[model samples]
Target chain A: MIASLALLAIGLALVVVGPRLAGARWTRQAPWLAILTWQALTVAAVAAVVLAGVTLLIPITAVADDLGAILHACAVSIATAYAAPEFLPGRLLGTVLAGVVPVWLLVCAARVLIGGWRARRALHRSLDLVAEPGADSGGLVVLEAAAPAAFCVPGRTSHIVVSRGALNRLSRRELDGVLAHEAAHLNGRHNLAVALSEILLRAFPRVPLFAVAAVQTRELIELLADDAALEAVDRVSLASAIVSLAEMRAPAAALAMAQGGAALRVTRLLAPEPPMTAWRHRLGAVAALAIVAAPLFLAGYPALSAALSDLCNI
Target chain B: MRPFGELEAAIMKELWSRGEPATVRDVLASLSTSRTLAYTTVMTVMDNLHRKGQLDREMSGRAWLYRPVRSRAEHAAALLQNVLDEAGDRQEVLMHFVADLDSASVAQLRSAVEAARRQGDSAPGDAG
Candidate 1:
């Protein structure tokens, strides 16, 4: 029970503090590390909460060497815990936390994945009709729109799409930069990373951490892609391409939520900063690992100590 | 299998350019100038497109005459509209190069890029 409470407390603290930690200045300089940290924080929080419930259902006294004996002890502990009036409420809460949370998460994940897949397939079908293969644009499907636009549809057969307006507005070098940016997105499989954050946001809309992480993930991904594009094109060209593409008109409602990602990206590109030092990178990786492992260690400590004592007696 | 997609594109292009209902034989003749395709292949592709609702078919004599449900420009406009409408909501479906910025932000960013370019020109060695 004490371990379960400790785990729950850790989860709550992480939910409150994770966003602030991720929003630090260092994230812009090292987006890959930042993305890793964000993923670790989210996974740890979910694991902590779920483990808290499981630890409640299975008391430390239920620890045993064999599977059968362990199961028997867990069954007896749960039955006795429920039978006692004093423990009934805690047990009920545990049942809901352990049983309901995972199932709810799974349902939400399914909805997001299936809905995203259907939407992508439909978009691909539309592309087949209205787009033609570009002549020398590196296999990009050229759409016949006059509005400057560019995007990539990711799937087994991913396509980088650019409109005729973009072609007309951008120089050859600028267009190459844009294509490189979209290629970075597809090569890195950034879609899956974004989807994971989206799932959490959908599952718990009210949680500040999930909400903040979703927005941050989207921004970081654009930065990451820009960084990749730098390898193939000059900063000036890429920055200009970003500026040209920003001419697209969005709805008024979305303008309020827009972070002006283009501005941030262009600034970073123009005055690039040195990446994190080797030692700092190592420190960041270790911190991410610790965040994920802390909950598991907290929930398992009691059982681990009990087993150690049993071995000593033997 | 990849060529099938190209063939579908060719068939659609042929139908749209003809500006009238065309039989499978008519499409095959226009397409044969570029590459030889079996008659059954053209028929099967058109049949699939009709099933997918991209084309409408009517009986002309003994054969089905196929026409695009919408014009090429209309399809292109609808595709662009769909993309812009869903851009804000569906991040997983597509990764746009840059989200559309308001006019104010666009002006700010354009100037920023201009400044960067001026700085780069001063230091020739720094340009990639």
Candidate 2:
């Protein structure tokens, strides 16, 4: 149990800090996006290779099972209490997760509800910008503000909002660029990216590397949006608009691809790789998968096999 | 508009008639002598086209050369797609346009789709 806890701790620590120390070098490359993707691949590859390699060498299958069963048993008791909340659940966390599952879960459930309410309230409040009615493939929701920008608030139903100042300033051509950029954000599920980054960062705050990785991921999301807009419109127009809007683009607020600054995006737009012809895109996807698998292989078979077995429990 | 009114369409048209990445000077030179154009005005027009996402540009010393990123066929297809997407449930309008497709063109489209399906089928993981 001590060893397992140590391993988990170390893993979490690496997850948090490793990105900051090393991720910066990659984001500086010519096509920051290509490098961003490469870093993501690197993270997955490292994780997989480490897990598979450790699993191959160490056989902790039995102990892991015992630990998992204990955890599961605890979970079941907690779930039961929640299912039947009449059980006088005294301070849940202080008592329930104190090896008394039911009370803990009630506490957790309460916490989650409160957190969700707060989050919803914050989201409703943040959307201070008015929505402009746009007629496009998916109706566009524009926020007319002086903040030269674009961003998609991600969820079950995504909202693409842009600033009013952006609309007023941009020519129709430039407006197309901004609209397409925002569309790319929606299509890419960048809100998830932001959420994932935040979760990863919060989970492993010590690892400066994780923060670096998150920042890189954020920038890459913008680049990806720029790439999509290029296809919908002309690269030059996108690039020009990005340059023009750099002054007006907002910083990342929640889910949107905060309008990018001029220098990097413009460079990429002016000289994109012919939209990565289909074959090349396929190659990239394949490479990403391979990298994703490497760390899983390293995590060691015993834990993996145990995980597979546990899947039956689900 | 001038080109449409008088350009003798034969082996070439649009950007091709002038050749790829033609400059304002190049296009003006080709234009029949009617109006004198200053460099900045022509530059601005090309710039506008570029900004409109109609033209792609490349750096050439102090100036930039521009090209049409999409071919004429692609532009037409995109316009058609855009119209279809915009026309909310305009079945009659859509059917009228579909009827306008020449028999040979329709045949070509059918063959193209068949070929695409065949190719897709042949590709790994394409089958359910």
Candidate 3:
């Protein structure tokens, strides 16, 4: 029980502090690794908390001394609260924490998804009316407005939108850079990642990890797309396009070509860094593995042993 | 098959080609030659276009006559311009548009363009 509580404490602490410790600069330096780290933290934190709750029930049923008796005890308590009067409080708390929290999280996730779906439907309906098939061969839709904007709507048939303003304002090279950036987002399926992060953040708002991860993931995906765009566009052109288009806004549901942290993106473009070394890559992998595995082992091992012993004793 | 934006394009084409305000019936007759469509569908499409500020409608007797609000070229430009006038958190929606650029940064970009031009290198070309 003490060990379970300690593991749970560690998990909670990680949930609160992990993102802060990572810091924005760390993530900006190695976004892919940062993504892995954030994902592991979120998963491990949830697993740890749930496992901790379940583990607490282990000692209460330890008298049973085996797995079968532990289940029987749990079922009996749930059926009639008085069945295990001595351990009723722990049983109730464990059941509530382990069962109710997930359901609540699931509900929150559903709400975010439904909202996103509705927003997408509304946007597509309006976009269909306002935009025209672009003259460019890439199957983009050109909006008549003079706002120098470009973005991609993600779906079965994703459409890239480029305003006439952007086409007129940007030189050929600059326009290509902008289009490539938007295309990178579409091809990479960054919308799904952004959506998932959004769902998780809304579902678990209190978990500092989710909030930070959501923001960082959003930022990282843009950087990733920018990197992909660099293959076809020179640094100066991409940077210039990003700056010029910085004033244009994409709809909330869509991933705009040059959204958020424009200055940081521009700076990174001008002074590009070499990819991380193999040793650093290995270190990142190992760190991610450890972060994900720690909570599960700490919380699960004790619960399993206690449940087995309780069943045997019963 | 008419997909997505094509309905609006077709309706706009009819209006633009007629070069005059026409009733829904007139637009429908013109569009029907390409592909048969119901009057209500055409009416609804036109009504939506009007609501979107793409079409202007005026009542003629008991029926409403509609025309393109602007020339095809002007309309396209207006739609793109509207993208800049969106109401929301400016930072949140900031995408390709530059909200802020100091004189120095703009100058730097100009020089970069000059260098690129001198080198005869265009943006390595668009998406493959």
**lDDT of model 2 at residue A24?**
43
Interface RMSD of each: 3.7, 23.2, 7.6
lDDT of 3 by residue, A1-314 (tens): 56557667977888878778456465666777777777777777777777666665544333344556556665444333212224677678777667876887788778776765654554455566657888787757888775456766666566678777677777788888877887887787776666666767887777678888777776777787888898998777887687566433333224433234566677777666777777887798799889888877776554455445534245
True contacts kept of each: 0.63, 0.00, 0.20
Clashing pairs in 1: none
Query: Can you rank all candidates by lDDT, best first?
Result: 1, 3, 2
lDDT of 1 by residue, A201-257 (tens): 999899999988988899999999999999999999999898877755434424455
Candidate 1 i-RMS (Å)? 3.7
Q: Candidate 2 on A114-204: residue-level lDDT in tens?
A: 5533443333233322244555556455553344444444444555555555567766777787777776666665545544444445444
TM per candidate, chain B: 0.67, 0.51, 0.58
- Roughly what TM-score does model 2 have, to 2 decimal places? 0.43
Where does candidate 1 stray beyond 4 Å?
Answer: A59-86, A248-258, A311-314, B1-14, B17-19, B23-66
Q: Give the Cα lDDT of each candidate.
A: 0.82, 0.46, 0.67
Q: Per-residue CA lDDT of candidate 2, range B1-128, in tens?
A: 11111221211234654557876677666553655656676666667667767678888987677787655544433433333233212211111101122233334333443454465468746421
